[model samples]
Target: MTTILIKQVSWQQHQPELQALRQQVFVVEQKVPAELEWQADDEDAYHWLAYGPQQQVLGCARLLKTGTLGRMAIAKTARGQNIGLRLLQAAMDFAQQQLGLAEVHLSAQTHALGFYQKAGFVSEGAEYHEAGIPHIHMRKKLSPQPQLGISNGKFFVSQHKNTVLTMAQQCRRQLRILDYNLNPAVFDNQALVDAVSALARRHRNSSIKLLLIDSQAVIKRGHGLLKLQRKLSSSIAIKQLSDDTGVSDNLVLADDCGVIVQSLVNPETIWADFNNKPVAQSKIDHFEILWGQANANNDFRLLDL
Candidate 1:
């Protein structure tokens, strides 16, 4: 196996190398038309070049400003070395860690659908012809938006509300929230209510469980989440922790991968990381113990489904 190294290159500094690689793969080998192959966007797009021994270009891919990833090509000699996969990872890492793009879109050659799918991209719509080749639209959501909030920072009320809502929008399988009171300003918002509702319809096994220290106040406040739960009783469950439970931190877990942690002692102090499975799992494990001991607030039983 050959060692593969990937690096982002500038069109201005590495034009000869970039063009040579693309021309070799996309034009000569694939017979893509020379006129159609060269685009003005090359100069502005983010270019990633994979190198073999002695810094020879092995593969290349580009990400456009609009979050489109394309122009991916691997040398014939390098096809079996996983050079293409590493190059694609480089592009995606840059998009998520540096560019802060919420998601990426690509027109994948139909035959390569499985290749991209292996990297967590989902294919959408029917196959269409592009440059005389069958292609399909595909996209992968990067780590969810309103990204990680460090514990050192204090959030304004609006920031906290927006972050939870944005995180809720990305939930797929399940959403588990453990909070002090299920604050009306954050959990009762229409945006979160709608997101949870949509998630419930996404799968029959989808689950939403909320643990609150106080349910009487939430019910009296006419919370939208409580209302949603009553209407979707089979999909949503709300429980109240007894006073004996020592938990004081508020947590919002999305799909068991994303998390928003807030200090109940200091509501403004918060931390949100949308891609930390370990932290989410640990917090969820503790939450489950509490969830099991917590009583299903009978108040919800009074509302008609």
Candidate 2:
């Protein structure tokens, strides 16, 4: 089996490799005009490359600051291996976690519409010609808004653990989490860990404050977020509730824009709001008061293996 690795690269650092892959896939194989393939916007866009076992470039893609995903190409030999999917996912991750964008847009070739659709992209407009190739406007909404509410507000009820984690990734400036025992099942998800790690790495002034009533379960199971808190001590902090104040509601707040609140007694029933400011702010203020009363926890260190 061949191992394939996908990573982000700078235009200046991996110019030759990116150019070679694009030339082979786009210019020669697809017969796209040279002048049209190599656009001036390449310099300003963020680029990514997918490499095979021997470090050979198999695919490439770029993301614009305005959330446009374009110039995606996969080598002929790598077509059936899902390299394009990885490249597209990398672009979407960059747009959300690193750039803090709400959604991603792409001009997908009409024939490849099915491919993008599998990745959650929906066609927005009629097909048109771009550089002699049929193209259509497509977009993928990155943030999940609440499912129910009025014109200015909406509410979401998440029954599964992944839904709550997905909401946490949309957090940009600040994140406040409250739960009982800080259950490893919820905080140990790899995707959620990566999202939080990327957020801390991209935003220097961002804060992630976690408050748990009991951390015995998490400590026994080895939580990834605990390890992350230790590594990013300045940005992430873990605390234990010193009193019984505000322990009934398990919540996650993202800045002043979004919030997820579940009853600690009934974890399955979760209520979240992505657009309502007043509701989110109320939860945030309650969190701050509880946070102030919480005590710093230093027991998250690695245990003997």
Candidate 3:
């Protein structure tokens, strides 16, 4: 088996090497115009070069700042050696772990769709021609993401119920949730209640604050989450937003990292980011403002755990 090592190199340092591989695959063999093949983005992209055991460049690729992968080329001499796969994997690993990218996008040649698909990229839209070649746009999510575009009218509750459970399981020292009535399907379920219960007991100083607009729904419908707050009130406290505050969004913050935001009563837009600290912190700050004026739910005394 041929051994190949991939390295992240600068365009200036390895211009000749990078140019050689891309030129062989794109301009010479594939006949992509020389003017179109060499791009200004080449100097700015995250470039990767694969080397053989003999120290020859085997393949090369570049990842743009906007998370687009392009200029991927494997020398004809190195075809079928898995160098392309290795080069692509290294680029994606850097984008996710090192660069903190949420996803990566690429344009795949029509004949190479299967190659990118095997690497977890999904094709989207109709086939289009690029650079006089049949090509299609593809995308692959690299980091943890919330499938937040749930718009099903009748099955909406079940769609994102798992999202709540996921964010809860990822919580560390703090979890803040602001909801109107603790949407029964999403938060009142036993699985989520148990997860939050475990979170409260796992970290001693962990603060789990739930801000609700009303507790009447849980009182009438008998929610397991209501039972949880009653038993773990010391670690997990529930509060009610002041009626006059007029907040109308469902927001959940998990340890200042994960966030879920949705419009309440008129929930047309729902979004979540599991690895965004800045966005989560911003929402938590807003939650704190509401929590400061919020009062503890005295109604929990109505239920005995």
Candidate 4:
């Protein structure tokens, strides 16, 4: 077996080799037009190349600062050797570790959806033509590294009401949210609404479980999350806590890896967000226990009100 090595190289360091490999795979082999294969964004992206034991470039991919992964191509001879997966993993690592990005997105050719899907990416949107080939947008959220202490993890503090949405974008498998009133000001924003919808679309097998003290506000506001729950009813679920449950903290847990906890419902209240696995898991376990006893909100008509 030939040992394959993957490296992050600058455009100045491996432009010729990267361009040659992309041309061979995207242009010649896949029949993509040369004009569409090359783009100005390539100038600023971080490129990863896979090299075989003999130092031959087997594949290459690039990561843009905006969390877009593009120009991924594996050599014809290197197909079925797991080089593409290695390259993608490298790009994702750089994006999360170096760029501090919460998620990575890509426009995958429809035929390659399964390949990426196996590596944890979720496909979204309708299939569309790109460079005369069918393509779909895909995304994968980066899981935060486990931290033993609060001082060692990435921390976020915000009075901005969209903090929940920011936390949602970092979720990969599960999103457990506990809030009072299922606040419309927080869940009804267009951006957060779209993020939830995208999350449901991408992670069809995952779940977003919501526990709220009251649903009247969400129902009265015609919130997007409610609409999304109706459309993707299986992937998302809602429950209402009894008035005496004594749940005062607003919490958001992402995949048992990251968490955001707000002590009160006031927008001005200070909140803490971090990527501590143990802490997040403890909260998730507590939430599940409470959820088990919570009452399901099956009234769809309230969402329409």
lDDT of 4 by residue, 90-112 (tens): 78767775688999999999999
Q: Against the hidden reference, what TM-scores do the models get? A: 0.49, 0.51, 0.50, 0.49
Please report how far candidate 4 places residue 160 from its true position, in Å. 36
**Cα deviation of 179 in candidate 3 (Å)?**
0.6
Clashing pairs in 4: none
Task: Give lDDT: candidate 3, residue 186.
Answer: 76
In candidate 3, position 33 carries an lDDT of 92
lDDT values, one for every candidate: 0.79, 0.78, 0.78, 0.77
lDDT of 2 by residue, 84-108 (tens): 8878876776676568899999999
lDDT of candidate model 4 versus the reference: 0.77
Global fold similarity of model 4 (TM-score) = 0.49
Error of 3 at 134 (Å): 19
Residue-pair clashes per prediction, in order, are: 0, 1, 0, 0
The lDDT leader among the candidates is 1
Q: Rank the candidates by lDDT, best first.
A: 1, 3, 2, 4
Candidate 1 residues 96-171, lDDT tens each?
6568788999999998999999988999999999778899999999753344322223222214666788778878
Q: lDDT by residue for model 3 over 33-127, one digit each (tens)? A: 99998889888888988888799888898999899998889887888977777778778866764577989999999899999999899999999
* Regions of model 2 farther than 4 Å from truth: 144-305
Model 2: lDDT equals 0.78
| TM-score of candidate 1 to 2 decimals | 0.49
Give the range of the ten consecutive residues with the poorest summed lDDT in model 2: 144-153
